[model samples]
Target: MIVATGDYHVLTDILVILERWTICHRRYHHCATSLRLKCTEL
Candidate 1:
């Protein structure tokens, strides 16, 4: 039972980390695109 609980916690932590990583990556991509567009305009 203890082993199962530990495994579950690990899985949850991994999922949370993956979600945060994906969100941050998307934000970075958006910021980069906007900066490129502004530079082109100038």
Candidate 2:
């Protein structure tokens, strides 16, 4: 039971990290696209 609890905690941490990573990845992609468009216009 203790092991299961530990595993669950670890899983939650990993999920949180993955969620943050994806959020940052999306924002980076959006910023890159906007910058590219601006550069093209210039």
Candidate 3:
């Protein structure tokens, strides 16, 4: 993979953004599922 310094920084920024989104998405899904289960049980 040919990566210049500018491209590297851009890629790093994208990766960081993606990682943040993934963490938030997982947390949201987990909370939503848990709430659904609790509500169903109640």
Candidate 4:
């Protein structure tokens, strides 16, 4: 039972990391695109 609980905690942590990574990646892409557009305009 303890092992199972530990595994669950690990899985939850991994999920949180993945979620944050995806969100950061999306924001980075958005910022990059806007910067590219600005550079093109200049």
Candidate 5:
């Protein structure tokens, strides 16, 4: 498997971005669920 240096860098950047996005999305989903639960309790 031969990958160009530049392509490898780009792929690494994309993976980092995807990891950050997934973390953020999970946090947002958790917050939304909590808010909904609080609203229902009120």
Candidate 6:
């Protein structure tokens, strides 16, 4: 039971990290696209 609990905690931590990374990546991608569009317009 103790081992299972430890594994669960590790999984939760990994999930949190992945979620943050995905959000940052999405925001960066969006900003890059917007910048590209503006450059093209110029």
Q: Candidate 6, overall lDDT? A: 0.65
lDDT of 5 by residue, 2-42 (tens): 99999999999889877766666655655777654544342
lDDT of candidates 1 onward, in order: 0.65, 0.65, 0.67, 0.65, 0.68, 0.65
Candidate 2: TM-score? 0.56
What's the distance in Å from true for residue 23, model 3? Answer: 0.1
In angstroms, the error of model 1 at 26 is 0.3
What would the C-alpha RMSD of candidate 3 be, to one decimal place? 9.6
RMSD of each: 9.7, 9.5, 9.6, 9.4, 9.5, 9.6
Q: Which candidate number would show the highest lDDT if scored against the true structure? A: 5
Q: Name the lDDT of candidate 2.
A: 0.65
Cα displacement (Å) at residue 16, model 1: 0.3
Error of 5 at 17 (Å): 0.1
TM-score of 4: 0.58
Residue 9, candidate 5: Cα error in Å is 0.5
lDDT of 6 at 30: 58
Give the TM-score of each candidate: 0.58, 0.56, 0.57, 0.58, 0.60, 0.55
lDDT score, candidate 5 = 0.68
Error of 3 at 4 (Å): 1.2
Q: Model 3 scores what on Cα lDDT?
A: 0.67
Clashes of each: 0, 0, 0, 0, 0, 0
Predicted model with the maximum TM-score: 5
lDDT of 1 at 40: 38
